[model samples]
Target: MFSESMGRITGLVPSRFLTLLAHLVIVVTIFWTRDINVQASLPPDFTSEEYEEEDLNVLPASTEVILVIAVFVLKKKSF
Candidate 1:
C-alpha cells in the first residue's frame, strides 16, 4: 500500500511530466496576467509559507549503508 501510494504521488513518468508542465503553465499564467500574488492569498487562519526552490540530495553515508545492506542481501545463495 505504501509503495502504491508513492507510485501514485510520483505518477507514471510521462504522465507526471505533463501534469507538472500543466501546473507550471497555470502558475505562470496566474502570476503574469493577474496582479494578485499567489503567496499573499493564503488563509490568515493558517501560517502561510513562501515557496522555496530546492535541489534533492541524499546523504552519501545513508547511500553507502544502503548499498552495503543490498550487497549482503543479494549475496544470499539458494534460489
Candidate 2:
C-alpha cells in the first residue's frame, strides 16, 4: 500500500537523491540566516554563594515506599 505513492512522481529522482537535496537545502538555509556578531553575557553581581544547595535525601525514601506499595498491588492482582 505504501509503494503506491512512489510511482506518482513526474521526476525520476531517486529517494536517496531527494533526501540529499533536502539536507543541502537545510544546510544552506542555516548558513544563510546565521548571525555571526552575537555575544554572550552574564548578569551583574552573579555569584556561586547566592545559590543554595538542594536537599535530595528524602526522594529515595518516598520512591522506596511507592515501589513497595506497587509490589504489594501487583502481588495481590497476580494471586
Candidate 3:
C-alpha cells in the first residue's frame, strides 16, 4: 500500500524534475542579461550681475512697493 501511494505521487520524477530545472534555468538567464545604464547627467549655469553701480541710494532697496506715498499721506514724521 505504501509503495502504491508513493508510485502514484512520484511515478515520473525524471520528467517533472527536468521541467522544473528548465524553468529555473530560463529565469536565471533572463535576469542575467538585461538593460543596464550607468551614466549621469549634469546641470546648466545661468547667472548675470550688471546692475551693481546703482546699489546705493537714499531710498531703501529692500522693499519693492511704493509705501512712501501712502504713509506720508496718512501720517506725519515723529521728528
Candidate 4:
C-alpha cells in the first residue's frame, strides 16, 4: 500500500516539472516580447518618452499572483 502510494506520487513529478518548465518559458517569452507588445497596443504616434513612462509591470505582477493562487487551489483539490 505504501509503495503504491509512493508510486502514484512519483508519477506526478515529471508532469509537475514539465508544467513548471512550460510556465517559465511562457513567462520569459512574454517578457522578451514585451516591447513589441507595448508598441502594438499603443498608438503609432506614441513617442519613446511616452513609452518610457508607461506602467507595464502591473499586469505581469498581477498575473503572477493570480497564477500562484490558482496553483495553490488546484494543488489543494488534487490532494
Best by TM-score: 4
Q: Tens-digit lDDT track for model 2 on 27-61?
A: 44544433221111223453443222111323444
Task: Give the per-residue lDDT digits (tens) of candidate 1, residues 1-79.
Answer: 1257444333365575577566555645553533234334434443323322111122333455555556547866531
Residue-level lDDT of model 4, residues 1-75, one tens digit each, is 224745456546667768876776677676667777777777989988778655354366447756865775677
Q: Which ranking of candidates, highest lDDT first?
A: 4, 1, 2, 3
Candidate 2 local lDDT, residue 74: 68
C-alpha lDDT score of every prediction, in listed order: 0.44, 0.42, 0.37, 0.66
C-alpha-based local distance difference test score of model 4? 0.66
Error of 4 at 33 (Å): 1.1
Residue 1, candidate 2: Cα error in Å is: 16
lDDT of 1 at 25: 58
Shift in Å, residue 57, candidate 1: 31
RMSD of each: 15.6, 18.1, 33.3, 5.6
TM-score of each: 0.31, 0.30, 0.32, 0.56
Q: What tens-digit string does per-residue lDDT give for candidate 3 at 1-79?
A: 1257445445455676577566555544433332111011112332222122222221242231234334436656432
Error of 2 at 34 (Å): 0.7
Candidate number achieving the greatest lDDT relative to the actual structure: 4
